[model samples]
Target: MSTSTSTSTVSEEYVSTASRPSDLRITDVRVANLHGVPFRSSIIRIDTNQGLVGYGEVRDQASASYALVLKSRIVGENPCNLDKVFRKIKQFGHHGRQGGGVSGIEMALMDLAGKAYGVPAYALVGGKFRDTVRCYADTPSLLDPHEMGERLLERKRRGFTMLKMDVGISLLWDVPGALIAPAGSRDDVSTMHPFTGIQVTPKGVEHLASYVDTVRSIVGYDVALAADHFGHIAIDSCIRIGRALEPFTLAWIEDLIPWQYTDQWRQLTEAVAVPTCTGEDIYLTENFKPLLDAGAIRVVHPDPATSGGIAETKRLGDYAQEKGIAMALHLAASPIATMACVHLAAATENFLALEHHAADVPFWSDLVTGLPRPLIQDGYITVPDTPGLGFGEINEELFRQQLDPRDPVFFAETTHWDGEFSHDRLWS
Candidate 1:
């Protein structure tokens, strides 16, 4: 497919030299590190021989090295042939933060593909299911339940119809008789849920339940509410906490245990009244199959940065729909990743709501240009009809202001990663 852009204003045009997708060849890969936009993040830029640059971001808290290391593999390929390039590099990815490289590249490729075909990213996958994507506010935890409720009410005042909050053992640390942890197990965060031997007492359950009750009383039943980050507690405690909070009618309880324990997830799902949701740390669509096949979860939450970017995330959502499960996305990165999720959620039929982690960051929307101000309004983001992931360009001034102090590089040259040292093929 051949495409052309007019020599218009910077916000209305993409600077490019080549007009045909067939002639596009990747020339270089670079990264910009940003910290304290809320979380540490790395944004990637892939330059092509055609002057068409595609943008993406690594998973929040993941190293930029994850993407920089793959520069050698994709330096000379066509960005529009996504699956062909994905297959060649996906072997380098695994679950959790390790998957960031492949997924980010996939997003960049999708962006280039859309621009090459003169369509939005959603069109390349299929057509969109909705014109605007609904977003849920992700709030941090506070020490006081009433204070947290008031804080959530503030989000509701801003027009969020859905919300998620942290309700974990972090709250019970001070209350005497609230927990039963053996010696050396009091502040354990590394032990697996099954081996932790940390149990929430009856008082602990009541204490946690009261927090949700306060929030529910303030927010009312007019909006959907979800809870997460319940600490590394065992399944029995997960079930207990899930049952106690059932009275408030939570939308779902997330990550009570790790996502890999499908059998344990099934047991918790069957035992609780609230819907069980997971898959944020999961890498690809195939790994989600065991959870869907066993009826272990009611909702699947995949961060595009960790779940394999726009196309793979769409595939995962489609497969979950076939199994009668709903899909919600977990996102906590820059505007590039947010727009990617917006396109993915727009195209997926069973999509629930996209998480907006930067709702409170004043400069978050300023990171990109050519989009509406207050990018989210009345709890929804209007999907862009523009080509690619649908933003004009990175707001260089604002981006520079948020650069990570440790490595304040803005799309610097990456010639060191240009030479491939070993063969990358999986089979002869």
Candidate 2:
């Protein structure tokens, strides 16, 4: 018998030996914890026997244990079978931060598959629609209206053409007679949006609109300015505020009321000239179907880390586009999650712009090494051609400098998160 085999006529025995479990078995799962603005962030790495690793992130403030527990179910399986792995794990996920675990795991799997096949993450989905992803920056609220105007001007100076800001009623807190509520209870938050009875006085309305007026005066009409964080006011107040700002021409007023109030969003959307947007905390596509079907809002904002990873978010965007709704991603995590959004935005045609929440952090872009230097420039991130989320390695030294001092651990041992706690099957 000859030991040598021809390249075209390779033996089945040789093929069997070269393929299967040995070449791509899962080896380990590790996590690095860092502080993303407003909360903490956990970055997970899925390492295989072949030395390739996939990276993902649990939504900021979500416990990394949500993803680590699934390690037992997938330790020895092929990381390349993303859909199979996702289906097996999707049952365990729910809405909000609960979805973070499953979505993060899905992101890691996509990263893995992208690397194994030598393609960009978006290529694994539906391929690229654009090479650069536009980004929007969030400006913090300032007590002084003039200072806020100056602050917004600085962002424009930095070349960001699109911006969002907090326009909550909290601004009118100190203004006597501006708001009327229960003696001590907060009127802005009652059983629901309509019942809140949180009306803005004629003066208060002017005060709130003045914030937008100042920003518009400085940044002018060239920028796409949006508003959010209205301090949980009623739909009526949201409409009142929205109506007052109609002249400013905002891109959208985000999350005017809770997303669950689909009818409220519809009413506000119909009543106001400004566009309405929501759904950053949503988890599944089906959950978003009703809102789109009702023509509830003009835009859908999904944070990939909280939504059902890439496929679900893309599905949401596709469905939104079908109904003429644009998708503007909501992201506030580290580079791990940012790249995931980049790939998703690349593959999605209706994507408007992804959010960049760490502009003030200074070291935010310094935490990762694989993507282009200055991850964002002039409000746009040029998509990287490299495989697996396009990041080379975690810049640990830089990351450590910004790690949350209260809980600093870089890929710490999580052996206890290794086992399943309960049977996850939902239906009998």
Candidate 1 local lDDT, 187-276, one digit each (tens) = 676888889888999999999999999989999999999999998789999999999999999889999999999999999999999999
Error of 1 at 327 (Å): 0.1
In model 1, the clashing pairs are: none
Q: TM-score of every model?
A: 0.95, 0.93
Clashes of each: 0, 1
Once model 1 is optimally superposed onto the true structure by TM-score, how far is the C-alpha of residue 132 displaced, in angstroms?
0.5
lDDT score for candidate 1 against the true structure: 0.91
Q: What residue runs in model 1 are displaced by over 4 Å at the alpha carbon?
A: 1-18
Give candidates' CA RMSD values in order. 4.4, 3.0
Model 2, 194-269: lDDT tens digits are 5665677778888888878987897889889888888656777788888999999999999878889888889999
Write down the lDDT of every candidate, Cα atoms only: 0.91, 0.83
lDDT of 2: 0.83
